[model samples]
Target: MVQSIVEELEPLFNPKSVAVVGATTNWNKWGYSTFTSALNGFRGPVYPINNKESEILGHKAFARVTDIPDAVDLAIIVIPSTGVAAVMEDCVAKGVKAAVIISAGFAEIGKEGKRLQDEVLSIARKGNIRFIGPNCMGFWSASSDLRGFMFPLPVKDGPLAFVSQGGNVGGAVVTSGFMRGVGFHRYVSCGCAADIQIEDYIEYFGEDPEVKVILAYIEGLVDGRRFLDKVKKVTPTKPVIVLKPGKTDAAAKAITSHSGALAGSDEAYEAAFKSIGVTRVESPEELLDVAIGFLTQPLPEGRNVAILTPGGSYGILCAEACATEGLEVVKLPDRVIAALDKVFPPRWSHGNPIDPAGDRNLLTYLTAPGKLLKVDEIDSLIFMGFSGFSIYTSLFVSRESGEGAPWISSREAFREVAKEFTRAVSLKDTVKIGQTILPIVSGMASRMGIYHEEDVSELTEIIAAAIVSGRLRVPFLVSAFLPPGSEALAEMGVKTPPTANEASAHFLVAMAEQWVASYKKPVLTTTFFTVDQPRLEGTHYAYPSGRHAARVLIKMVEYKEYLDVSQK
Candidate 1:
């Protein structure tokens, strides 16, 4: 039965030909958006089915689905609720295997809407046609290049497959994943779930070879028992990360109105997820964080963790957060402590949160994790700050403002603009602009002669170590260390012309570029401390906060625990 559902959804995701029912030439309508989006990425034949228009965005329009000359494997129905039943009938007559209903005004509205939804579902079921939604934004597929989504953003192809009950939430997750270097294999917003429930998507994604991690933003469930059953089979092999909202009474009511899904008792949902080995996160941010962990890092053998930080405060925060998540910050063995003592300065914290107080040596950051991971007590490790590599890059890009430097009008003007540059990175366009500018800067910066071959080799050694750890299946995570901010740059700003540090800065940036070239993965490290900067490419992402890092490690440990028990 599970195999049958998986086979049925195959055409829905990678249909050879698609017809957009109720497609229109009008730019404002939902029909037009879905039609154009379908044409953008979907390489197969796309027929626009519209009675009113002769053509849509250049494709010849058919008055009805049955009128299309070729068989339509999938139909995207975007007309009003009153008109969807007729389209379904036409789709059935034309042998449409699957559909995604983008039009709203269905079960989410009230009794009349529910009746309309039932009518549509009846038609679809009778025809053996499975559909996605009565009110969904749409979906995207990396395999078929299908851009069936409402808003098409540049998405990277990776191992994460996401299913969301809410359309807007699904869109947010996709866009956020794109920015943070997290990629998706597929994305679906299953609204109303009149025909195809969330469990079907989960079951299919679990079996898919392309998908390594499954993420869902769920408002509520139609059948808790079915969901638990479906997820139980998937969790032992693949990680299922979910963010289920509606914990409060008011939010529970809202969930019902939003998707016509009953927000079942939050406690029941929590206990079920825990038992089934589902990693439930509180917010969207944490959902992505945990997903990245599963995709990049290995599961720990136990809950014991080691924290390494340049500052004592970050170490303290991570330790506290680890405790809250039921993860242990294990005491370092005497040999491990003694090994680190030789590398760190005299002021370093001697305990588990290995705080090398005021140590700016690059070698310490690269070598310390090796020592910790070697010990039997430590199952995982988290580094709290950016590696010293970023400091050199920050110094490289920063130049002092002279009286008439063309880059800025004055130091005061530079300060204001610098602050704005930091602020601008939050927007999508700014990120696009930064992506365009990075390669250009990299090209010019590469010409600068090598500053220190020894430093470059040491950084290379760190990358080599990371690759080895991943090969050996050791879990390691690091906090995102951003470039210096406007304030720091201003304080360090010089008034003279370009000095010898210019060479040093270029060399530092060269070292980073070398790191990126060797790593050969998508830039997971944020460049220039902004979204626009080149990400430090590595096997694992540098997390934004200690709490996020701690939570991810705990979940990884929990998953390992489940596997341990289940295997026995």
Candidate 2:
């Protein structure tokens, strides 16, 4: 059903011939940047349309869009508010596949602009054409070499794709996310959305093979039902992360003014997102963090998280933070404690977050998470602080070469030497440095932190999604997307934590409940055998949407298969 629309949107993403209406020669204007970006990225034919000049940006310019010699697959409209209607008429006459209107004076400017926006919409619909925005930045696809955006996105191909309702946030995501190594397959800033809504992009991007994860920075949704339907269909295959602003009434009002979006009740939006299996992050930082997590972290086995750190206080701090988020600072199980005694000294604080008090080796930092992952008690880990990366980095360089210590011309290095010479490496000093500069090094960038954080996070979600769908390597997972019943969790001997560490287990268990819930109602009074393996993937049922009788028949078939497997 959506394939038709996907086909319709194909040329927009990768066009053969693009015509720029209101093309300009000035570098400062958007008309210049938007069109040039296309020329810069795409190797296809580009035509510029301008009234006065013979040429713009060294490309042959035409007075009207209909004068282009070839079929215009995509048009970038950048004319004035009053001139858009005429431009749309010419675009329709030319029979272009789609046009991206990059002008600003649309419905967001109020009634007069709303009427202008409607005129363009009416023409596009009647002309059997589709367009992107009349007040937005437009879109880009790395695979197609299609950079229709005003921004020069990083030259990288990432598994993530983002669609933002606001152009500012879209630009911000491209610029800021690049520094953190987050890239995109495609990025679209859906401005005004006069012709296309957020849901259309969701459906389009969901079908994108290059896109493994979808991140949306939405101010509001025009059609919530359509959004829910499309997201429900797509989420089982790819994780959709949305950062919806306008949570407050004040912000909601602002959202309407910005894009004429109907920012409905936040509560309704939350429930709708939840029901459709969308992961909603509250802030930009969480959006990026969770996006990275989805891209890199592993599926956690259980809810009990063990914080691995060099300092006891850092471990305690992590414990406090984890507890606040409903995570369990698990007491180190007897087996793990017994096992750690070999590597840890006699004074090791033998607890859940087994901080071997005096262990200062960076190798210890490197090998801790995998060693901990072996224990069934721990499902995930958050490494609190790390070694002085700058100091460790110095070891590989020529700076600390000649004497016991290198001749330091820099005052800062000499100051450090004097301070370190006079003071001893005390417990308080370790905690102090760990809390201060050491955290910056290990926060997410240090070698050990990057490996563990990325590994544990991506794996946990993948396993979570796999456990729910009974399909490993299902494109993406929603953090904490499940609501499994207590009976099932009890059967697995799992105590679901309030925080997100156990989210994978919760995700799988919840999906299983959704599939078997209706069937189990009939046998509520009876009991059945259960599986106890920490990962109960067999229980995760990938039940596609169907009628009630059809579901029952599926369950019956599944039961027969289960019996066969059990017998074998």
Candidate 3:
């Protein structure tokens, strides 16, 4: 039944002719953007309906929906909330099958508003009219170029499918996606959701062949059972990332009042997410980061991570994070260690968190990463260093004070060495390598005598460039949750902390490690930050944060051991 609905909605997005009710000549009104953008973005025929205006945006206007010369497949209603019922009636009379109502001030307002909402739905039902929203901001359909609302910015077509309960959040997600090199296949802003709900969009995105990853920003779940059912069906084939807000009592109250929604117990929501295999996210950034990872990197089989860094401190922090996430930081074998030793200074660490040190030239960088890539023991590699190494040749040279200006000569020598090193590290590897390029100028300037200000700035810019180029070559997985049964692995010696942020990072690494171990595939990794900690009100209650961690851990377990094969 659900599958049939998804198929029906697909064409609405790719309609042949669209009628815009309440079309206005005034550019200040939403009618202008909605109508104009649709005409520009969508290549289909557009009919503008407005009794007051002869034309809108240079297109002849019809007096009413029924007056349109031909049968329209879709209708976009941007009229006032009070007038929507009448417009819908016209749509029914004209035999418009699908509609997107971008009007607000309905169920989200109050009981009176809800009555008005029900009136609109009643009209649609009687006419058998399927609509998207009464309070939604609008939606963008890449395949059909169906732009139905006044989105502030232009959106490029891509594979990511995004749905959000909050219109503002949806817009923000679309905007952020543009900056991060992410693209979208479709975007639906299900505002009050008086008609078509969140689950409907979820089901649609799940079944969308062109959409490889689905992202949602939800404040409340209207139907838990149905949502879970769809999640169970969708997650194995594609990655679904959800960012849900309003966990705190005060915040939850505000959200409920704002949307006129009954945000169920956060604990119940968390349990539902886990039982169905949904990846719960802490922030908007985390949602995007994790989605990017799922879109780019392969699902990891197990939770064993190998840390590779340019500095000892960074390595230590990564190791601590791995331990907290229950990932095993196994020691390198003698053969692996011997290979690294040949390229590293005596002062460099010989353990699992391999640090080649500051003085190590470009040859050592290439050699160390190559050695790690060949070792079967390491599941994935995390490279941490300043962005300076990526761009400036001078940043790699050691300072030399001499009348002969030996530093200049040294810099040239290092450039040759660095080029060779960059090429080696950037080359494809059987094991996944994820690199973190820190802003070096700021760090160096903060250190009293480590580097001069000019040198620091130059190094920072250089490393930034290198980091950008490296990212282009190596696909990175954002943070992901570990599957269940990770608890058993935890019992096997993996340790995780109680904090959600730390737990999320740890679980991500563990999942990456587990992936390499189980599937013999390389996985790249990254992290997202969060400060949220929701409380559990009862024994049966679950903290949203903890539940999120559990979901990630369970995913890892499933990926590694095939514990939950039904999802696959």
Q: Give Cα distance to truth, residue 35, candidate 1, Å.
A: 1.0
- Compared with the true structure, what per-residue lDDT tens digits does model 2 show for residues 1-568? 4347689888788788888887789778777877778788687888988888898867889999888888889888877878988988888888887888888898888998899899999999877778888788878778678888764556356778888888887777776566555578888888989887878888888998888778898887777888887777777667788888777889998998999887888889888876666777766645654565454433333346666656676556556655655555678777667656644667888786668785664433433444565666665555434212133322222222322122233446544633542242222343333233222233323433343444333333323333333342111121121233323223324454232333333433443232233112110000011121122132232111111112222222232333344346
Measured on C-alpha atoms, candidate 2 has an lDDT of 0.61
Cα distance off (Å), candidate 3, residue 189: 0.4
Cα lDDT of candidate 3 equals 0.62
lDDT per residue for candidate 1 within 158-237, as digits (tens), equals 89999999888788878888876778998998999898888889999998999999999888887888988898999999
The root-mean-square deviation over C-alpha atoms between each candidate and the true structure, in angstroms, is: 11.4, 18.2, 13.9
The order of the candidates by lDDT, greatest first, is 1, 3, 2
lDDT of 2 at 128: 71
TM for every model, in the order presented, reads: 0.78, 0.69, 0.72
Model 3: per-residue Cα lDDT over 248-272, one tens digit each: 8997887766677777788887777
Which candidate would rank higher by TM-score, 1 or 3? 1
For TM-score, the strongest prediction is: 1
Regions of model 3 farther than 4 Å from truth: 1-3, 390-568
Residue 222, candidate 1: Cα error in Å is 1.7
Segments in model 2 whose C-alpha atoms lie over 4 Å from true places? 1-3, 386-568
Backbone clashes under 3 angstroms, per model: 3, 15, 31
TM-score quality measure for candidate 3: 0.72
